[model samples]
Target: MFVSVGVRFEANVEALNMVETAGNYSKHRRVPYIIEEKNVLKIIYVPAVSGESLAHAFQELLAEEAISEKQKVCRKCLRGEFLKSMDEENAAEKFDGGKLPSDAEKLEEGIVKNCTVEDIGGFLYAGKPPVKRTSAFQVSYALPIKKIAIYSTVEPQLHARHAVMTEAGKKTGGEREGAAEQMIYYVETGTAIYGFTFNLDLRAIGLSAITGKPIIPEDELRARRRAAVKSLARMLSSTQFGAKLSRFLPLGGIVSLAVSVTEKPFTLTSPIYEGFEDMTLKRLEKIAKEFNEQYQYYVLGRNGLETPEHVMTQLIQYLKERNTL
Candidate 1:
């Protein structure tokens, strides 16, 4: 049996969690195992035992701390440039000569306003002129599976779940169903972390250098990973911000209607100021709202309204029919 699949990096986190659980896995033999940064694979020439053993092996793999730790950093390293930038500023001589970060690093100048938690939002992203996304913001979204396709033994629809199962079986084959099984489980919750890096000094220098201020050094590096993490959990699995965004940001265009908006900037526009907040996540509560509306409007037409699900169904079918979606 050869089951092949490609999962998002975030999904891999849960895989580790699942494999760590002893009862989630069962290893019957020494099957070949291959684990890649973004891919996992397994092939067995045995009977039903192969399937069961693979499942357990995956669980054990998920339980490992190294796997989880790597997953945590995946979000931070999406842009190798950004990570390098942060590291550079961390060692710059500008630290002793520059000023210290007041609240943030990228948006160090962003005054710690008197605004309440209700007033906090992620950074805004405005595209270059002519596009007119005045209120559009940015979000560093690691879309784990942007285009998932499988060309192997089973149906395409079965690839996702079977991928993890196949990887697990190779780790544990004949082990009894107890601690061994718990080790076979992986994080199957489909949750990914969404948050912006709080960079102040480095961003300032990259776009508009903020000269070293007196006693307050500017070269020192700091990040708002903690703040972003705190804000991220407020959403439902990092995709649904629920109703919390309505207060800080209105729901109208794409910018206002997002469900889980991040502060990842897409570009610098005319109205954009060369400052820190330029890339900081200003409002993240409303994500993809505008995209959904536009999709529905274009697909279903303004004369009639269709539920997102219905519109999406039609869109998928059309894509499959034309092989474009």
Candidate 2:
């Protein structure tokens, strides 16, 4: 249940005892942010009464804040003072917790890992991929496009903007659709990297297919999911996928990698959306289904994921697949 404490910014949950967690933006940190403008800031503060109406409220506030030309101290200076005030005040008073909880303790869902091998030629010899963080962990991956797309509203990761409420945000962030899609890293030897972007409009996205509701409270969700899915996909494909199916390449071409949530309520619920359900199950199921199918082909499609379970099952199948392989 969502505790009505206040609006949460970059917090997420982790997993243990082999439970299935979904929908949290575990990888938003690694998402590259290109600073389009120097010292950029966002409009996030909203009144508690607005509740679910926060997005609209935020929109109005952002416009006013952007135009207000009153000579005021820069945001950085204000943040510094805020920190100083917190120091003078008891830690417990500044934050309910004496100190913020470490990210590991907060992330209650998803597997985090990195590529064991990525900088093949630079880091290692040809074909020898570098060892990265963990599979479930979010890492930087990219895809290059000759052009870009449009979004009615965009939450750009540029200049450190990490999310958006719509698919256009995905396009602006240059993220793929689906958590199963891997984040393709396009090494632009020709041009400056990070300039390439993906613009997705979540408003145009069809979350209804998974959730019964048509509204998504966390607008930046789709883009975060897109980046995370692909990152995990790559980790799964090269690592877990390799370990699991060494002996049988796409066994019977019917290999299916899926998640059997040993957890509660959402293990069965779909991503059809609940504005309240932060972890949507249907979305997880769909991601897993796609991952399983793609494993058969042994390709990640530049940067793509076949399913959320692709990495989930891949992690498990690796142990089983290796024994027989």
**Which portions of model 1 miss their true places by more than 4 Å?**
1-138, 141-209, 212-225, 236-238, 241-325
Model 1 residue 64 distance off true place after TM-score fit, in angstroms: 33
Query: Using alpha carbons, what is the TM-score of model 1?
Result: 0.17
Q: Model 1 residue 292 lDDT?
A: 30
Error of 2 at 62 (Å): 29
Alpha-carbon lDDT, every model: 0.22, 0.22
Q: What digit string (tens of lDDT, one per residue) describes model 1 on residues 1-325?
A: 0001111121211111111223433221222222233475543221011222322222222122212322222222222111211322321222335333332333322211111110112122121111110111122222222122111011111111222234456566633433343432322222222111211111221121223332122221111212222222222123222111322221221111112111232221111122212221232112235433111111122224243233334433432343221
lDDT of 2 at 223: 29
